[model samples]
Each structure stands twice: as C-alpha cells, then as structure tokens.
Target: MSASVDIRSVSKSFGDVHALDGVSLAIAPGETLALLGHNGAGKTTLFRILLGFIEPNSGEALIDGLKAGCRQARRLISYLPENVAFPKTLTGREVVAFYAQLKGAAASEANAALEQVGLGEAASRRCGTYSKGMRQRLGLAQAIVGNPRILLLDEPTSGLDPLSRNDFYQLIAGLAEQGTSVLLSSHGLSELEARASRVAILRQGHLVADGPLAMLQRDARLPIRIRVKTKPADAETLHREFGGRRINGASVEVTCEPDEKMAILAALHQRPGAIADIEVIPPSLDEVYRHYSRANPDKEARS
Candidate 1:
C-alpha cells in the first residue's frame, strides 16, 4: 500500500524560541514534496520531529495513519540526514551491512546496494577514505536498502556531482513511480522546482504556502515575469498591447496572472515578425520565501 504523511497542528518550542508554530500538512503517497525554506526556518526541526528524532511540544506527526515513532511507521520510513557520520574505522561495505541488518534486509542485499550507488569497487575501503560525494552515496544506499515506503531526505545531493545529482533525482522519480513517497528538504530551489510535484513553503516554522507548484505560484501572489524580444520600434507598441512596460530598446517585461500566460503568448505571436522570442519566468521558491520573510519580518527574524 502507498504511504502518506499527516502532520497535524504540530508545534515545537525551545524555551523562548519557537521552532514550529501551528504547522500542519499532508503528503500523499508516491508524491515528491519539496519543503522549501531558509536556514532555521524550522525545516530541519520539523523533519526531525517527523522522523521521531525529536518530539513536538504539541500536535501529531503521523505516517500511514500511525504515530511517527510507532513500529509500523518506522518500518515504512527511511531518513537521510543532512550530515551523516559513519564510523571511520568501518569499511563502506561493513557500514552498509550494518544498516541493512538494522532494517532487516537480506545479507546479500549489501553488495547490491553498494553497486546501486556506484560504490561497488570502493565498498571495501574505509569510510574515512571516502570522499564527501561517496559518503553521500553511501547514505543514499542505506536509505534505499530497506525499500521503505516513505523517504525523508535532507539536502540529499549535498556533495554529489552534476551527473550524480541527475541520477539521484532519476532514482527518486523511479521510486515515486513505484509508490514510494518522498519528502525532500533542500535549499536547492532550482533543482527542487524541476523535480518536485508539489512544494510546501515554510516561513518561521509556519507553512505559508502549500499546493502544487503552479498553484503555489498563483497563491503566493507572485508576478509572472514575461520577457519578449522585439524590434526597437515595435517594443513599445507590443508592450502597450500586452499591458507590459518596455525595459529596453527591444525587451519588455510584464507581471501577469498565471492564467493569462497563454494569452500573453498569443498576443506576442500576433506581432507578425515583431516578436522574436518570448519567455515566461515564474517566481523561484527562493524568491517566494523571500517574499514571505519580508512580509513577516518579526517571525522570520526569530527563526
């Protein structure tokens, strides 16, 4: 069965410091949800609570209708922390085997896990000798070994190379296709924009925005940036026609509703060789986060 995460009115505090405040969200099975927020925005704290590494001061974190730390929930979930420390003395293979045993994976699964992460030949080398990327790969291997239904990843591609990062995303996509849910918390907004089916934005421990990528963009009141290339003389006319303002001799910029994007394109297309190219740029998650922070300076400042 597919897994789901239900976070209900979760709140956590450290003395006078509030980490999460009345936050609630749900992540459906097989969907890749990106958690976007700045440092100390309580993304890590929420992640920890969901993984049962910490208890929320109030509210519940449940997986597949079970409490966060319940046996069944633990069995169905795997977590890859941002900073993973393995015993320096143990070889990579040994480390994998150790975790495999913890997950009750077959002994023979260790080698395959190592190979899947492109660490087959280096499996015998001590973790101390492994590079950061290699260590990250090992952590990913551990997360995947158990075939858990829900994967919680924090900065999963931290040290991976470009190719490895692409491969890692592909792997995550494959897992989602196979009914495995993934919750990813990352600062890599561009990458998350391309990978996530939905994005949940947190500001000062509160979920300021939650929905599909397109929906969030619309709900955030973010302007749609349109750039058009046109002849110097036609630029002004085109801008006036499209209700945009001319930025330069041949470039025009406009902030339009997301729904009007196609109409804007159609307007540009009607320009009869007047328009050379058109681009629609949505607000990046980083930009959206900044907007929220600016609007709630006191809350974000505390974070």
Candidate 2:
C-alpha cells in the first residue's frame, strides 16, 4: 500500500548542528508509528517538517502525494504539540470552534468533537479552570476538528492520569480504525508497546531502526527467558536437563533463542510434574532501545 505519510531522504541542518540526517520513513493508513529516541534525537524536528512548520534542507515531506505545507496538505494533516498552550479565558467550546473556523469546518461541529473527546460536560467551562487532562482533551478536540486523514501527536498523553490516558488512547485507536495515519512521539514505552503498530528508533540525527515491534525484537537478538516452577525434588534434574540455573527451591530459569522456545517447552513436558508453572519473558521496548544504542555507539560519537 502507498504511504499516507512519507518522508523521503529528508535532512535538516542548523549552522554546525544537524537536526535530521538523511531521515526517511513512512506511515501506512490506519497504522500508528511510534517515534522513539532520547532527547535531541530529531523526533520533534521530523514532526515539524512533516507538519509543514519548517522545511527540510533536502528531499521531501509528503502527505498523500501533496507536498508538505501545500494547501491540500493543510486540509489533510492535524498536529498537537507537546505543550498545548491556549487562550486561558476561552471556554473549551470557544477554543475548538475557533480552530474549526480556521480549518473551514462548521463551528456547530465543535461540540460534537468535544463530546468525542469526553469533554461534553465541560464544553462551556473556561480553559483556565480545566485540569491538565481536560486541557489535553481540548487540544485533541481542536486537532480533529476538520476530520484530517493524518494525525501528528507529540507527547499527547502528558499530564493525563492512568484513566485519562486510557481514554485518550481509545480515542486514537478509533481514529486509526477510520484510516487515519498516526505518528505519535512519546516517552511512554509501555503505553506505546501496547498501542503502536510499528516503531522507529532514532539515535542522534540518524534513523537506526524502524519496523514492527516483533521484527525489531528479533533483530535485536536478545535471549528469551523462561522460568519454570517444578516439584522441589526434581529441581536438580530440571536444571541439568534444560541447562538452566536454579533460582529457588522449586524454580529453574533457562534462556533460549526465539526459535528454540517451543522446542524447549516440548522437552520439558515429557516428564510429569517436570514443570508446574512457567513464564516466558520477551524482549521489552527498553531492552530494544539499549540493544540498538549499543550497536550504534559509533554513529553517536561521530554525530
């Protein structure tokens, strides 16, 4: 499928500093692509280029074949920055309605959008009195005003409580189901782990890794840990059979390659009570980051 959002060999430089270096990636329709990286890793800079706030020094940023910043692209792209500052005195409805007018959408649709973000009851309340999560929802309402095909959210769940965060992501999932391509840059690894269909990890200004989470994990080649609980009397046999270490009175831990997991489990099942309970630990987002960074330390030093 053709990409809904595309950045082709894009690069941006400021004097002696490079914010983006030959970066290229795409977001397919209905896919959520998480941008992962440390501070100064070019995620925000890429977002700015994609949103058409700034131009890249080379190559292209395209939204559904329209050049970035073109009139048509404006109608198809919506952005929510990390800091969603707005006029403190305006009611939430007023804030959304103002953006609706800017997007050439009907002001009457403002309440509908606010309701979609769970702001229906607080629609008439002034922004200054709204809590952080409420303000975030108000900002979200503004972004979805014109029914854009692409959404760019930067740290969107910031300041939200756990319940509010769940609500916010549900809203994002609904948008994706409607074929909206989402590029979300966030520091919340576990949240992204649950929601992102794919991820891109940036180191300094370079794009080091990009693909489905499972694919990246496989490429990282980290061990899969399996901990098995067995009859205390059989612990020694289990450890020797699996080349594992005894962790406690009845528990043994073994490490295996991804492809070896099922085979190892099948071997353990041959003897009764050989394993009472087991847990498989897969590579986490945090480990993936460490794996890639360690492999790319030279790139960081050069940059």
Candidate 3:
C-alpha cells in the first residue's frame, strides 16, 4: 500500500540558510512517527512544505500520493501548531464548530471532540476565559474534529499538566490505532522514546538519523549501561570483578558494548548472593540524538 505521507528528496533554502536537505520519509496508515530536531532544525520548514504553506526548492512532498498543498491533499491532513490561538470573543464550542464546517464535518463533531479532550464542561465558555491547558485541549479538539487521514502535531503537550498530558497521548494513540497517520514534533524526547513507532531526527538541515529506537541505538554503537545494587560489603568485590565504577556504598555502575550485554548479564546472574538488584539500560533517544547531532556526516560517509 502507498504511504499516507511521503516526502521525496525534498530540499528548501532561504538565501544563505538551507532549511532542509534532501529529506525523504514515509508514514504508513496507523503509524505514529516522531520528528525530532532543535530550534531551526528545519522541522517547521518541513511541516510547512507538507501543509502546502510553501513549496520546496527541490523534490516533492505528497499526501497519500497526491501532490502536497492540493485541495484533496489538504483535505486529508490536519495540523495543530505549537501555539494555538483563537479570537477571545469566540466560545470553545464556536471555535471548534467553525473548524468542523471548514473540514466538511458535522457541527456535532465539535462537541464530541471537545468532550474527548476533556473540555466538555467549559465548551460554552469563551476561549479567552480558558487556561493554557484548556486552550491546548481546545486546539486538539479542533484538529481532531474531522478525523483527517494525516495528523500533524507540533509541541502538542506544551501547556498540559501530567494527567492531561497522559490523556492527550491516549487520544493520539487511539487516533493512530484507527488508521490515522500521525507525525508528531516535540522537544519531549523521553515521552516520544516509548510512544513513537519510528523516529526521524533532523540536524543542521540534514536527515541525520531515522529508524526505530533499537535500530538507531544499534547503528550508533552506543554502550548498554548496567547499574548493580549489592550489599555494602559486596559492592567493592563486584566493582573489582566487573570493572565498573562505584556509584555509591551499595551501587556500582558499568557499561558494555551492546553485543556484550548478554554475556555480562549471564556473569552477573552467577553471583546471586552479591547482586541485590540489576538494572540494564539501553542508549536512550536523547543520547542517540546527541550522538547524531554532533556526528560529522562527511567523516561518516568516508568511513
């Protein structure tokens, strides 16, 4: 089946600055892809190109095989910007209803969407009266009203509290499960680490890395970290044998190559009495992201 969203060798430039450089990606139905990048990392530029707000200097972006920015493609996509704003005079219900009309969805969907985002009680209140978290939820309600084939979210959880953030993610997960292709961009690397099916990192206008978390971790060749908690008396012995540094009176921290993880675990298992607990941690998304951001692409290509 064709990808729901596809960008082929797309590049964009603004005079001296190159916003994107030959970035290509594809998202399948029901897939949730995370887009990671720092400020000016071409994330917004790429979103604009896909939204048809601007054309790329080279290559093409397509929404379900249709050229991006075309009417049919636009109808297939929905976007929630980082900062959501609405006229202060309009009520929450009015705001979403307007979007529903624009998306050709029934006005009743506005109320259902608002309730889905936990804004039901305040739906009649003017947006000007809503708190930041409430406003964010309102934005989400509008974005989801029509159930577009592609959903694009930017800094989606910015103003949400912990509980509300959880709800937000659950809602996104449900949408993806129902066949919506979601492309999410956020600075919350830790959150995306577990939720995203695939991750695409952009650095200095280059597609620095793209893959599942495990694949990126493997390709980056980062070590697996192990922290062992032992009896105070056993800590020193474990440290001596394992060659890891002591973190505390009862803890020793060690790192090994990815391929050595199983052997190390087996060795640790043999010392049941000395080891009180063991925690094995793989390279995190943040670590992998930093590794690629600083990696010299030119050197990597030559190697």
Top model number, TM-score: 3
List candidate 2 stretches off by more than 4 Å.
233-250, 270-275, 297-303
RMSD of 1: 4.0
Clash list (residue pairs), candidate 3: none
Candidate 1 lDDT at 32 equals: 94
Full candidate order by TM-score, most accurate first: 3, 2, 1
Task: State the number of backbone clashes in model 1.
Answer: 0
TM-score-wise, the better of 1 and 3 is: 3
lDDT of 3 by residue, 1-303 (tens): 789999999999999999999999999999998888888999999999999999999999999999999999989999999886899999999999999999999888899999999999999999999999999999899899988989998878877887888888899899999999999887646666367888888887888777887777778898899999997789989999999889868999999998999999999999999988999988887887777767898754332
Clashes of each: 0, 0, 0
lDDT of 1 by residue, 29-108 (tens): 88999887778889899888887889999999999999898778899898899998999999988988888889888856
lDDT per residue as tens, model 2, 1-303: 889999999999878889889989989999999888777888899989987889999999999989988888988889999896899999999999999999899998899999999999999989999988899989999998889899999888878888888888888899999999999887636656467888888777888888888887777788899989998788898888888788977999999888999998888778766678888988787877777755665643343
* Candidate with the larger lDDT of 2 and 3: 3
Task: Estimate the lDDT of model 2.
Answer: 0.86
The lDDT of each candidate is: 0.83, 0.86, 0.88
N/CA/C clash count, model 3: 0
Positional deviation of 196 in candidate 2, in angstroms?
2.9
